[model samples]
Every structure is written in C-alpha cells, then in structure tokens.
Target: RSDPSSFCIISRLKIIKTDISLDGTKKVLFELEDGNRIESVLIPEKNHFTACISSQVGCAMGCKFCLTARQGFIRNLKSSEIINQVIQIRELLDQPEKLTNIVFMGMGEPLANFEAVKKAVNNIISPDALNFSRRRVTLSTCGLVPEIERLGKDLPINLAVSLNAGDDKTRNMLMPINKKYPLKKLIDTLKNFPLHKGRRITFEYILIRDINDRLSDATNLARLLKNIRAKINLIPFNRYDGSPFEEPDEKRILAFQDELIRKNYTVTIRKSKGADISAACGQLITGP
Candidate 1:
C-alpha cells in the first residue's frame, strides 16, 4: 500500500486557469502555494508546437515594453516549478507528441535563475527524462552579459537575445538591463557564443510604432549584428491595457524587414499569436 503522507506533499504550483486565443494559442495561469501567479504559453506552428515556459514568477529586468516587468520581481522559480509548466501543458495538449520545441521566453529571464533553469533544462532534454533533442530547446535572455557568458560556458544551448532596439539610447529607454550590459558588451558575448555548424542565434526585436521601427533603426541593427550568424525575428508590439506603445503599421514592419534584407541579413516577421487573450510577446502579466 502507498503511504498517505507522500501523497499529501503537493506540488508548489497548481493550474488556476487557461485561456485560449482565437488563433489557438493557449495561455495557462498557475498559482503558487503562497498565492503568487505566473503564466505559460503554448503556440502552435505549421509542423509542431512550442511551449513557452517561465523561470520566475515575475521579472526584475524592467523593460518598458514588457508587461511582466510591470509586475516587479517576485522570486526565482525552483527547477521543479519551472519544469511543471511544461509537463502540465503537455498533459493538457490533445496531441502531446506534437510538442516539438520549448522556448524559455515566457515570464522571467531564464538566465537570471541560472541554476534552477539549468536543472530544469537538463531534465527536459535528458534521455532518462523528457528526452527532447538539444536543437529543440531555446533560451531567450534580455542581454545579461555575465550570465550569458556563463551559459555559453556551461549549457551552450540555442540562444536568443531580446534585442528590441538597435541603438544604446533607444535600448536603454526600452530595456533597463541595457544600462548595465549595454549593446556593445551583449553583442560581443553573442559573437563568442559557441554555435554549432549552420545553426544561427536568434535576435528578437519588438517593433513598437514610432519607437524602434524606422529604416535607420534596421540599418543600425544590421550593422550591429554584422558577422554574427543570426536571424532577426521582427515582432510587432502587442498592445495591452494601458500600454503606452502602439503596434507598427504592417507596411512599416515589412519595410523595416526589407531594409535588413538589403543589408544581407536574414530576417522574418514573427506572427503575434494569442494577442486577443493577452498572451503574445511581451504580454505575459498575471491577470484575473
């Protein structure tokens, strides 16, 4: 017979609710034992689905455009708490096996919670555990230079930097982390990242209208990323309640991308999924 006491020890976090976007993306809210809440997103692509997991209950990075930053920092999630987001979403999926990718792009900067994130990532790709392939997992950071170096030394997984702005002035205004790491240091670190053959790092840029979508911005971004094997993902800003920024016009978005292409850089416009339910990029704040 099983011990009742063992069963009494419950998970630190529990699913509170899940909201589905018209586009079919799922945003699940999880409440911690102490009542703090965090969110995770599941986005479906053409061939497979990707689980966007969180590493912190809230974020301290304080990016002006990110909803999570407004919540302020709560605490780093334990490895189990982080992994549970993935496991729970997998269980919720009608076709769990279709989950082929994982991105640490949800609530917190994964590198900030290094040890716990590392542990969770190991189990995620471990043959004895989830057994996901190395290429299928990605960690996105808001340009934490030292931590980025440490991650390159240790885990060396696929990396994506949230390079939302092309210059220091705009970047500093948008992402406060830029004040510390800055663009030069962050780019230098990315240039040194140990990428496998033909694998490129991803640079995510959120195009906020009248903010960082100008052709000059694209030119500067191309120059900044020159010689670095990277593909830029242009995400038009997803507006939420009381947000100060507006989405760039579709024509401008394509123009910005075309400028980068002219500069010989590979770029793509990322479709903003789950925007209706407030689950798109930079919009993962806890809600009612």
Candidate 2:
C-alpha cells in the first residue's frame, strides 16, 4: 500500500463534479500529487460512445507538445483507479447506445503503467463484466517498443503510437522516448505486430509550427511506413502554458495532409476542440 502522505495533494483535492448537457453525461475529477487531477470524459458520440481514460497520475514522457508531461510524473494509477473511470462513465451514461470505445489517451502513458493497464483492459474485455470489444479499445503509446511487442501478443486491443516527428533527429528532440525506441525499431515491431484482419495500427503525428511540419517530413514519413498497414493522424498542436510549442498554420497542416494523401496513405487531420477547458487529448492534468 502507498503512504497517504504521498497522496496528500491528491487527497485534499475534491472530485469537483460536473453535469453534462447531453444525455446523462456526468463526471468527477480524480486527484493525485501536487494538486494534480485527471478528467474522465464520456463523450456521447453518434451511435457508440467512448471513454477517455488515464493510466498515470502524471507523465514523465515530457514531450515538448503535451501539457500532461509538463506536470511531471507522480505515480502510476492503480488498476482499480483506472477501472473506476470506466465504472463512473457507465453510471452516468443514460443513452440507448453503449460505450463502445475506451482510449488510453489521457494524462499518462498506458504502457508506462503496463501491468495495471493490461489487467484493467483484461477485466473489461473479459467474457464477463463490461465485456468491451478489444478492437474498439485503443492504447496510445509514445512508442514503447518492448511493451508494444508484449501487448501485441497478450491482448487484441488496438495500438496508437505517438509519432509526431517523421525522422529520428527531429523525433529525439521533440519526444525523448524516441531516443530509446527509434523509428526503425518501432516500425519493425509494428511490421510484425499480430493485428487481426481489419485492424491497422495508428500513427499519431502532431504538427508543430515549422517544426516537423514540412512537406519533406511528410514525404519521409511515407517512406518510413513502407510495408506497414498504418493510419496517420495529423494533430495540429494545441498550446498550453509552459509548453514550448506552437500549432502549425492551417495552410501548412493541410499541405502536409495533401502530401500524405499523395502517397496514397490513409490520412486524417484531427482538429482539436475542448482546449479552452483543458479537456483535449493529451492536455489532461490535475486542475480545477
């Protein structure tokens, strides 16, 4: 058991409640150290919905573009804590449709908290309990290769790698994790990934101002995906205080998208919303 003193900041933090306008969309904040909290989102999208889940209290990935990393690592969230987010989302959801998707796209790296994440995933995906479809669930990683290869065999959940920089030189400076698990090793791991038919690994590329946001970067990106079945998601950077990054201009972002389209790769540009409320993907940190 962890010392409560370690969780003092979190313990003092009240799970400030919020009621949604949509059909039964309600949530509460989960606190961690240093007044840190993670927001649970039960988005009532179309027919099937999704739960935005957190794996760690804070992140050590320290990506130049992410707000969570700026907060620093507190600790890995327990399996029950991870499971609680889903249980709460399920309770508040009063719609006719079920929660079909669960994303490890919140505060911390899911793989960094491997055992807990894996167990929680198994709990929900098991034949009993919530019985969530593994395909609909996605675990986002900063390209943790060993864990990635491990998960490939252990579970059937989808994998999304944060590959913001197309090449190593830029990637290493942008995402420190890339220095350890470079593109070649990451892709090779993915190339051999045991994804079932109809499932393609996702590559999430965030576009920063003039940095890793060029045409050649997109071209080089295409070369890197040579034989891998991957979907590229280009996210325009979302700015927050203490983050040393700028969102790429609209024209530049689209031009980069067009280049990837020219390469005949399945490409998507995700326009981020909820930044005003600090609720966008990778922006969740402990706050009011």
Candidate 3:
C-alpha cells in the first residue's frame, strides 16, 4: 500500500471569468487558493495558439506604463500554479495541440520568481509532462541582470527583454529596474548571453508618444543592440485609465520600424489585441 504522505496533491486555480476579444484573443481570470487573482491570455495565431502565463500574482518592478504594477507586489506563484495556467488554458481549446507557444509576459517579472519559473519550465518542456518545444517557449523580463545570467545557465528557452528605452535616463523614467541594472550593463550582459545558432534574442520596445518614440531613440536603439543577435518587437503603448503615455501615430510608428529595418535589424510591430476587453499588453489587472 502506498503511504498517503508520499502522494502530492495539487490544488487547481478556479476559473472566475473569461473574456474574448473580436480578434479571438481570450483572457482568463483565475482565482488562486488564497483568493488572490491572476490573469492569463490565450492568443490565437496563424496556425497555433500561444498561452501568456503569469509568474507572480502582482508585480513589483513598477514600470510606469503597466497596470499590473499598480496592484503592487503580491506573491510569487508556486511552480504548480504557473504550469496549471498553461494546462487549463490548453484544455479550453478545441484542439489542445494547437496551443503550442508559451510566453511569460502576462502580469509579472518571470525572473523575479526564478526557482518556481525554472521548475515550471522544466515540466513545460519535459517529454513526459507538457512536452513543449524549447523554441516555442519565451520568457520576457524587465532587465533583471543577475537572474538573466542565471536563466541562460539554467534553461536554454527563448528570452525576450523589455527594453522600452534606448538610453538610461528615459529607461529609468519608465522601468524602475533600469536604475539598478542600467542600459549599458544590461546590454553588456545580453551581449554575452548564450544563444543557439540562428536564434536571436527578442527585444520588446514599447513605443510611447513623445517619450521613447522619437527618431533619435530608434537610432540609439539600433546602435545599442548593434553587437547582439537581436530581433525587435515594437509594441505601441496600450493606454489604460490613468496611464500618462499615449501610442505614437501610425506614420511615426512606421518610421521607427523603418529605422531599424534600414539598419539591417529584423523588426515587427506587435498589433494591440484584446484592448476592447482590457487584455492587451500592460493592461492586465485583477479586481473590478
């Protein structure tokens, strides 16, 4: 007979509500065991779906543009809580296998909860568990330098850095973490990060009007990442209540992308999805 103590019991997160955007992006609100809530997004792609999961209940990084930061830091989720998000979201799809990609860009800084995230990633890619391809899993961080170094050694999964500004002064105004890591030091770390052949690190730059959206900022960005193998994702700022930023005009956005493309950098403008339901990037927050 098996000992009861030897069996591990996993408590599931309750699905409190779900909101679907016209674009087919579904945002799920989950109630944790302690009644604290977190949200996840199911993004429908060309052929597959990507699950954007959260590593922490709320965020401590305090980026000026993020709504999640307004809630302040709650607690780091357990590895089971993190993995269960993917599992439950996948279960909602008609063809679960189509849910292939997993991105840690939902609510909090993933590296802030490194150990739990590492354990979750191991299970996410383990053949006997969730069995996801390493290439399809991406973890986005707000320039957590030491954790970024540790992550490279601990997991070979895809990495995406939220680099909203090219210079230290502007970055410090946007993400408070920049004050500690700074732009030069952070770039230096990324320059030495281990990447598999043909795999480039993704730099997520949120383009905010009159802030980090100027032509000079784009040039500085190009110069800053000149040495690293990088692909840029230009995200137009998604405005929420009380946000002090606005998205740049379409022409300005194009010019920003063009500057990078002219410099021989791969760039893509990430379309704002689920905004109608308040599920777009940096728009996630729990409670009414």
Candidate 4:
C-alpha cells in the first residue's frame, strides 16, 4: 500500500442544495472548500440536458444587465474545481448520458480565468477524460478581446459572444468591458476566428425593454455582423429583485427578430427558462 501521509485527499465541492424549476430546469448550489458558493444549471433540451457551469466565484466585468456583476469579482476557480462541476452535475442526472452540451454561461467569465478554463476544456473534450465533443461544448464571453484571440488559437470549441447591443454607446451602457475593447475590435476579432466546416459563431443579444430592443437596433446589429458567419440568439431580459431592467414584450421581440430575418440573418428567440428559480441567463449570483 502507498504511504497515506504522502498526500492528502482534497474534498470535492459539496452540494448545498438543488432547486428545480417548473419547466424542468435544475439549479445546483455547490459550496467550495473555502466556504464560497457557486451555481450550475441543468437545462433540459428536446432530447438532452445542457450544463451551464461557472468559471469564477463572482464576475469582475460589471455588466449592468447581469445579476452576477452585483456580487463583484471574487476569484478564479482552479482547473479541478472547474472540471468537478461537470462531474458533480453528471452524477446527479438519472440518465447522465442525456447531458450532452456544456455551456460556460453561468456566473463568471470563462475567458477571465483563461488557464483554468483551458485545462478544464482540454479534459472535457479529451477522449480519455470527459469525452465531450468539441462541437457540443460552448464558451460564452462578454467581449474579452485578447482572451478571445487566445481561445481561438488554443481551443476549437464553439464560441458564443454576448453581444447585447448594436452600437458602442448602448453597449457601453450595458457591458462595461466594451469601454476597453469596443464593438469594432470585437467584430474584427470574431471575423478572423478560425472555425471548422459548417460552424458559425453564435451571437447572444439580450433584449432589454426600450433599451436594445428596437427595430433600428436589430438593423444595426445586422450591419455589425454582416461579414461574420453568425447565428443570433435573442434572449429577452430576465428580471430579478432590485434589477433595473425589464424584458421586452413579445411583439417587440418578434419585431427585432423579423428585422434580422429580413436582412437575411438567421436568428432564434431564446425562451426564458428557469426564471422561477432565477436560473435563467444573467440571473445567477451567490451570496458572500
């Protein structure tokens, strides 16, 4: 037998609690060793489930529309902590094989914790490890330009950019990171990103009421992404307590989608899921 004192076994994340939404979405709260907590969401798709995992305890990028930003930046998670999220979530599934897709759209910015995310992603897609297909794994970012370039080179997984606004002024008001890397620089980087055959970059636009939901905004968005191979996902703003934003009405939402379709761009309106449990996009946050 090996020497027991050589190394100590680090404990995995403890599951604090799980909240299931009316629509079948499951939100799992995990407590880390340091007593900090993070959330991971299990979203039920047509035939499979998608796990939205966190890369950081809290977020540094203070996007006005995101609830996590309210918590401020805490720290980046270790690679093991990142990968453990997937392992733990999978174990909780009755049919674990049904969990097919993994999205880094939870609490923290994945690119902010680049090294750990890269390591976790490598393990995620490695045949001997998690065995997840690269095509099924997606990482979402709120426009971290340099990290975006680096990610393109290091990882070949699907990319989803959170492009909530069409113009710089509106974007600046929504996502503060836009102040450093403006819209022009972001679009240019995405245009140069290498993609495998039939793969297109996904642009996520959160349509907040009377803010970035106008038909003109949609027209501007179409112009902004004209040259890139892109598919747009229009996510209506998900509201939370003390949030200053509201979701646009269905009429306005469809009008925005119509404008993009009229411009020959493929778009889908993402249905707000798990809002009852606060597990929807931009609604994840953990207490200090």
Best by lDDT: 3
Ranking by lDDT: 3, 4, 1, 2
C-alpha lDDT (0 to 100) for residue 17 of candidate 4: 98
Please report the TM-score between candidate 2 and the true structure. Answer: 0.88
In candidate 4, what are the lDDT values of residues 65-137, reduced to their tens digit?
Answer: 9999999999999988888898888878888888889999999999999999999999888876788899999
lDDT, model 3, position 174: 95
Error of 2 at 251 (Å): 1.6
Higher-scoring candidate on lDDT, 2 or 3: 3
TM-score against native, each model: 0.95, 0.88, 0.96, 0.96
Model 1 C-alpha lDDT versus the unseen true structure:
0.88
Candidate 2 on 110-148: residue-level lDDT in tens?
998999998989876875556777878899999889999
Model 3 vs. true fold: TM:
0.96
Sort the candidates on TM-score, descending order: 3, 4, 1, 2
Candidate lDDT (C-alpha), each: 0.88, 0.79, 0.93, 0.92
Residue 20 Cα positional deviation in candidate 3, in Å, after optimal superposition: 0.8
TM-score for predicted model 1 compared with the true structure: 0.95
Scored by Cα lDDT, where does model 3 land?
A: 0.93
Question: 1-288 in candidate 1: lDDT tens per residue?
Answer: 122123322464688889998989999999987788899999989888999999998899999998999898889998888877877788777778888899999999899999999998987787667777879999999998988888888885799999998899999999989999889999988899989988999999999999999999998999999989999999999888888999999999999999999998889999789999989999998743
